[model samples]
Target: MLYVFLSICCSVIVSILLKLARRYSIDISQAITWNYSMAILLTWLFFKPQFQNLQAAPIGIYTAVGLLLPLVFWIMASSVRVAGIVRTDVAQRLSLFIPLLASFLVFGEALTPLKIAGIIVGFAAILCSIPWQKKTANRKVISNAWMYLVVVFFGFGAIDILFKKVAAFREIPYTTSLFFIYSLAFIIALTGLLIRVFNRKARIVWPHIMFGLILGVANFGNILFYLRAHKALASNPSAVFSAMNIGVITVGTLVGVFVFNERLSLVNKIGIGLAIVAIILITLSQH
Candidate 1:
């Protein structure tokens, strides 16, 4: 439980730092690339090379997760740009319904009435939170941010399912799985950066790089702690971690409103309320 709490805390802080970076003229792509590099290094430093005996199945699963690195960063950055941090986060978190349903279908995890109700409410919240305006007098006027939200939803959902599957495999060490997954992501990202460099469009923004380093360490903290927590509490670790959405939403909302000066419409407010209730119900159902 402590590990889970620490992971949630670190994730929240990372979000705040990422938002702050926008104010410093940081290049989002460079920042994300640097973040992944730092994450790879930090994960290695902590986990070391004790994962030499991990089975093939877990390695394959983590490799599939690594394939999502590029899409994940792109969609997350686009969502933040188009929908603002609060709404983007709401969309991202509420998308957990995808994995929940996937677990039921793939792993034969039974979904109780309470779980079904919570999932429905959560989906409704996400729908309400989406902004549909004819015209907006803002610089980041993205016509297809909703599409980016969908991408984030499915991308993260698949990643969660993969991680859960890897965790279920008894032969794989959790730390080893994470290290390989991240290392694969870093390799892919580095390749992309090199390609950009060859095109002479790879601008190195130092502030963004530093911010990415900070975010990388923070994100590593999140994954490390959560993996440890899942290992310690094998039964229904998803439910326990899912409950932390309340904390993420709370912190994201506060930061979005005060720091970013973002505003929510009435529908968005109602959506946030529904999400909160749904998260509470889901957590209670696990107990």
Candidate 2:
């Protein structure tokens, strides 16, 4: 449970840093590029993963995750900036519904009654969490923050599915696969950064590098601690799953509302509650 607590902190801290990036004028692209560098370094240092099984690795899934990670990360950053932490986190946590749906629709798994109920509630939660911009007298509604939230919801869910695919591939050790995926992701991110620099749309700023290093630590810590929690609670996988999702939403809401003073509509509040209930149902269905 301690690992779960730390993981929750790291997850929310990542969002807080992303929220702060806007105020600091940080180039999220550059920061995200450098973030993979740190992740690569830590993965190698901590896991000491072997690359001898590269030929057996699932390159297709690796490539997909490599492409999506930075893109979704930037979108999540934009979401935190525009939509506020409360709604963005709720949307993210509810994304678990995607994999559950995939089990039924794509993998031919039977859907239990609880899963069906959870899916219904989870869909409602997503709709409620959308940060709908109110119409002004001039009707000049400018914020498309809800779009970012919607993208984040689906994007992370896709990433999660890819990760599960990687995990199921037994030819390569999971840590080694992770190391290779991070390497590929770093290359992809670096390529995008170079293109931006070439186009004169961005520069190699020092602040982004520093912030990226810190963000990478928090991001990696979230993964590390969550894995630790699962390993420690191997007999009860549902506990880890439910605790992580519920914890992030709970902690993120408190920080967003109290520390950042983020305001949520009554409907959004209802969405957050439904999100928790949906996760509970999903976890129960697994049992």
Cα TM-score per model: 0.88, 0.96
Can you write out model 2's per-residue Cα lDDT over 93-191, one digit (the tens) per residue? 988888888988999999889999999999999998897766356544547888998999999999999999999998788888888888898999999
Global local distance difference test of model 1: 0.76
Q: What is the number of backbone collisions in each predicted candidate, taken in the order shown?
A: 0, 0
lDDT of 1 by residue, 1-287 (tens): 78778877887777666566667777676777788888878878988746555545455677788878755876787677667778877876776778788878987988898988998898889887776653367555667767777787778888878877877876766666777777788777778877887899886657767888887989889878876887788887656566568767777788888888887888888988898887876776676
Deviation in angstroms for 270 in model 2?
Answer: 0.5
| Residue runs of model 1 more than 4 Å from their true location after superposition | 1-6, 54-57, 134-140, 227-243
User: Best candidate, lDDT-wise?
Assistant: 2
What are the C-alpha RMSDs, in order, of all predicted structures?
2.7, 1.8
Off by over 4 Å in 2: 135-142
